[model samples]
Target: MISRRHLLATGAALGSAAGLAACGSGTPGQTADDAKKSEAGTPTVTIQFWMGKLTTGEDAWYKKIVKQFNEAQDAVKVELTQVPGDAWEQKLKAAQAAGKAPDMYIGVGNNVSVQVGNGELADMSDLLPAESWDDLTETAADLVTVDGKKYAYPMLFEPQTVLFYRKDMFTEAGLDPEAPPKSWAEVLEYGPKLKSKGRFGLMMGVTGADFGWQSWGWQRNVAGHLPISDDWATAKADDPAYEKLATFYRDLYSQEIVARQALGPANDSSAFGQNKAAMMVQGSWGISQILDEFDNLADKVGVAPLPTHDGTGTVPVTIGNMKWMIDGKSKNPQAAADFIKWAIAGDDPAVLLDYFKTTGYSKFPARTSVTEAVASAPDADTLNPWRKVIADVVMPAAALEPQYDWTVAEAFGKAMEKCMRGDDIPKTLGAVNTEIQGIIDKLKLAEKAPQ
Candidate 1:
């Protein structure tokens, strides 16, 4: 998950030319006829690649791997560029409009569906080897596939909702740290017991945008559907299950179990790290920040999948992943595919393993081979003990984040905020349903929904 803080930080340096140089011996706009011919008269193809700038050292890993690939191979040359997260959409759109877009670029999470609809991404099913596609974890593979055609190659996946708590605080509050809350009812029951004068029992997003995206997993747990129906033609917010989910959060705010004002964005762990809350609901990437900022609290932290409504053992998490997609109009589709396969799904797992290590093992690997490599590493467990819990418990049960229009998520989020602010639940939900139906009709989303 990309936190608001990270986005703001990168957004500040919007026009700066960072990581814009092309790697290897290839230059941008090199045509097939311009490729260097070998002794066999076969040309070496060069492809352009772009990725969003991530705060987790992902850019560095990409640069390193691209350099390594260029030095080790002669058949395909790759030119790499890193774009700021905030500027990515505008820049990529301009490039594509001018017909100078990079051959391949990183696919933004949850927005790939829109890109696919716009014909921005190329079909990868016939470009890469079938076994390479088979190597991806089922959940990861499903995320990048639309209508049974692979549009992107997944790099990593992070669970969007994980329970992180303080062991010492749990003990002080007369709760068992070893057994965290397994249901929404347990969370309510335990939250009050953990509250004190300065610190609250829980920390989570309470704003409209925060609640909108952050509630995806919880919505699945409670309602088994998003605000829109599967066909994307009707609004489903009026369902009793959605009302129940909204009312639960409203009670949490009204009773002061959680802060009336948000401590930080849902993706951030600063409040928990500063001891303002005993427990927090955050993405799995939060683990990386905690370990880096407060190494002393490493031993005091505990992780578990977010609890479901009835404690029925459902994981209640949305899988957040980063993937690479080729441009639909790329002149070097095969060369671009070769680079992606070598970096992520190749026989050698060394590059991918090093990336996981650099991320502090906070992000989960998308490929089974990379998972095995990480598990067999000597320092895997010692470096991060939560890996097993996330892999064995969270990944299997997690659902793909909804790929519907952003306005649909915003509509549901605003309704959730209204209920939390003391508005009548039924009235607010009814209004939300009408508003969402308007969106569906205006956008003709029913016709766009993948079959």
Candidate 2:
């Protein structure tokens, strides 16, 4: 599962820090002494790299890659540091203030937008080969590009929400295990039938904060636009579509289809694995957790795209991915770029293929070549049977996560929670409009909205 603490930090803390100007700090202490010539008289460049600790074997995979890169060359050396997720923002901020930030660091999902706005990321177009940029899928390219300048090298892509259902429970409830709900109305129709003693029909985020970011894709799916106007000048939460969307949540909560007390956070798969819920809406990363912690139920778990509002079109999903970026103020940007190229965008697909394998195929590759390599792997189907559904149905329907301030999303989330608690829908949404308008005006967001 994706780290909730890490995501929370990115949305809350980093979002608040995006307005600061880029610091003109000197290189870190470690790189200061590494400018000396090596034994052969060739100059050696030392660059620091930082990444967050992950529950997946990604930390070990990154370490192994760093070791291999260090041993295979002498022109450049990478010093790696693994920071805890919750501490990442604070540590990085401290380093930036001291002019000791790492030359390269991993970029969290939508946090890249904030970083780009702060001018903290360097353009990779000049550092890497043109083919490296061309290798990215169109969607991946669009995600890393802002104002036509590429800023990041994406590593992986994951759809934010997918439906995971228990086949055994469906069978016991006299429902067809082969056919799951394809629409929100069908989900409500199916929920009561699937519920039994000590179990809920569905599990999802019911609180305000959780609802804020988690429901991003759902908002687009239902309302056809986000809470803000296209020009980012006005609030659009008062749209009638939102009232329809709010009513759906109210029905789900009032009917007790979803428990008032959640079994766990929406990201956690333990509740589903232990049979507390027959159906769950979670990210693709949860598949890895299920295979690792509940291997016995792997066969019984089924994956599909989240249901749509009217069941007539593709359900929009939020795409979340990690990327590697160079610090704009780094003294050794070329060295850092070379390392990223060798590890992820190199001609040889072996390194990236191994990452997907090590992560149990839970994440999808960003490059077309890597995707092709993965499809042709020796044991592709045996590793994960749901890969086809995710790669085809879910991924093709995904939209990039919104890059606006988290505060805007929080206002809508609070409104959603109030609606679920049986508050006046018109009054709740009017408050959302006022709150978001204040944010837009205070931040001067209209002037900064993407052209």
Candidate 3:
């Protein structure tokens, strides 16, 4: 329940006071075996897994992963609890307060930051083979790690976002579908051509803001505005990257090429799929959905990295993986960690691929060997296509929240809403960045001071 700001303060204080004592232990808690002894008499160790709706068609793919896991193992039975991903923090906090919570659960970018920072997760440091884990992608691997201890594996892999264009729209606009814009200017130039079809050329216009603004915001992240580092805070809203970002957004808004109400809760935009909008930035999660919805989607839906600020050949597909972390307080840490190991092992992951027929590779396996196994998976028609592209395009980009705090994003959300409302670029951005800097300064001071 600790806020990230408070946690940073506590960490700094404890680091000074605990000094050498904190360095020897894997996690700042009682050992897993100690917790297990308290639950020794249970007939079957049902390891509670708080996960997104994936099992039983409430997001069936996740369920299949757990179901196959249960059938495959004898040491533990996974009790899969469906937790809405968006509200996972509330779920975890509520469950913790009630003394009823999952032993192992899925984690996304924000969850990892909040939970791991609070030390609510099991430090899978020694539970799983460290060598087996060494093969993970750095950004993907770092998703669940805080300090030197790791709590989750980057399970499903993808860049933060991908740029997809409507082939017909592009052709009509006289732009090549295969050759996407590489810089900020080209996208602006192409924005107007799709107007003949009554389609907005750019997303992030008020109409597509919810799903699209983050993509545009992430353009700054790919440009290297990270959250923190050993040297200093990596991301600052006032950074030139963000200033540039706001200016670019202002231009897009002024051009009137972006759709109105595109970003609001109910704004309808099928222009990208309807061959109306020329291009849109989306995540790997959208690939299968796009393929399913768009007629002749594969040929018509061109996939390319998003445009960069300086054409530095560095595209920021935001980097992250769906994560699974075990509760340090769980009664079955060993069993829980075992299940995670089994789920990711070679050939074993193919079982999950078999379960989700349509959203194949939507949850790309984390391991390289598993990726290879999926490459030749029997049901690859559903899985392989996305895996190849996601793997290729997901260059090491920025994570959503750098400090394991949503405050930065929350600040951006406010700024973005105002930007969409047509606020002044400099003053609005300066205010937001100041707010972000204020948070960062407090966290930094807390980190440096003694507890």
- Model 3 worst lDDT window (10 residues): 11-20
Residues 16-82 of candidate 3: C-alpha lDDT, one tens digit per residue = 2111223333423323442343245321356778876432332665676677655543335677778
lDDT of 1 at 265: 60
Q: Cα RMSD for candidate 2?
A: 8.1
Error (Å) of candidate 2 at residue 140 is 1.6
Residue lDDT tens for model 1, 1-451 = 1111222132212111111233332434333333344223343566789887664466677888788766554545688999876688799889999999999988757467788888888898987778778889887887788888988999888888899988899999989889999888899999999999889989999988888888998887788888899999989989889888888898889889899888876777878999999889988888887866675988899998897888887656787888888999997776787667667766667657888887778888889888888888888777788988888899788877887888999989989999988999999999999999999999999998868
How do the residues 1-451 of candidate 2 rate in per-residue lDDT, one tens digit apiece? 1111222222122111112232331222223233233334343667899997665467788888888777655556789999987798899989988888899999877566667888788888777778888889988897888878889899889988999999899999999998989999999999999999999999988888778877888899999999999888999999888998899889989988888877886667889999999999888988878876786898998998899999977778888888999998887777788778778877666668988887778888899899888989977668788888988899888888877888898889989989988999988998899999999999888987777
> What would the C-alpha RMSD of candidate 1 be, to one decimal place?
8.1
- Model 1 C-alpha lDDT versus the unseen true structure: 0.80
Instruction: Answer with 1 or 3, whichever has the higher TM-score.
Output: 1
Clashing pairs in 1: none
Q: Highest TM-score among the candidates is held by which one?
A: 2
**lDDT of all predictions:** 0.80, 0.81, 0.57
